[model samples]
Target: MSVVILTIKISHFINHVNKMLGKVNEEDLKSVIDNTKRLTGNLARISDNLDEKEIANLIKSAVAKS
Candidate 1:
């Protein structure tokens, strides 16, 4: 019963986000997509340069902050 309620709440939240994004203009949306791609590229480069131990520490730090 609780799991079903949680799923309903999450679905409503996603629907709300979709509605908001639907209102954004085309140029702004394009900029957001470009920035996301750049960030992904940067993450790939950073991971490629880091050792296993360094990557594990970075993950641990991210989890702690969140």
Candidate 2:
């Protein structure tokens, strides 16, 4: 997904967490949000580098063998 969508989802998650657990530490929450953004960005980059056609072919080969 796009970064915009990821940000909106993250914001909603933080809001939900805040509501469920009152008085969360701002520093801790900030750390979590930052880490999440970093991790998702890395994952998106990795996924972008992958060859979708190659992966699909591999999957099809495996299924055909089975």
Candidate 3:
């Protein structure tokens, strides 16, 4: 995702949390939970171009050489 879009999501999350401050209601709680889930899901979807085993092999080879 673009940095701009991430920034906007963070801004919206901050605003949503801020607005819920000093209030305790069922709807507010649910909204917070939903927003948290969405943000986490988006974060989990960020592109990962690394291979875990490849990294471990590279480290092992370097350690053996050194």
Using lDDT as the measure, the top candidate is 1
Point out where model 1 deviates above 4 Å: 51-66
By TM-score, highest first, what's the ranking?
1, 2, 3
Candidate 3's residue-wise lDDT over 1-66, tens digit each? 999999999999999988867476878888989988986665455425446776567558867998
Can you give the TM-score per candidate against the true fold?
0.55, 0.44, 0.37
lDDT of 1 by residue, 7-65 (tens): 99999999999999999998999999998899688768889899888977987997799
| Best candidate according to TM-score | 1
Q: Tally clashing residue pairs in candidate 3.
A: 0
Per-candidate RMSD, Å: 5.3, 10.8, 15.5
Model 1 weakest lDDT span, ten residues long: 39-48
Sort by lDDT, best first: 1, 2, 3
* lDDT score, candidate 1, position 53: 89
Which candidate would rank higher by TM-score, 2 or 3? 2
Q: Return the lDDT, model 1, position 38.
A: 90
Model 2 misplaced regions, further than 4 Å: 1-19, 51-66
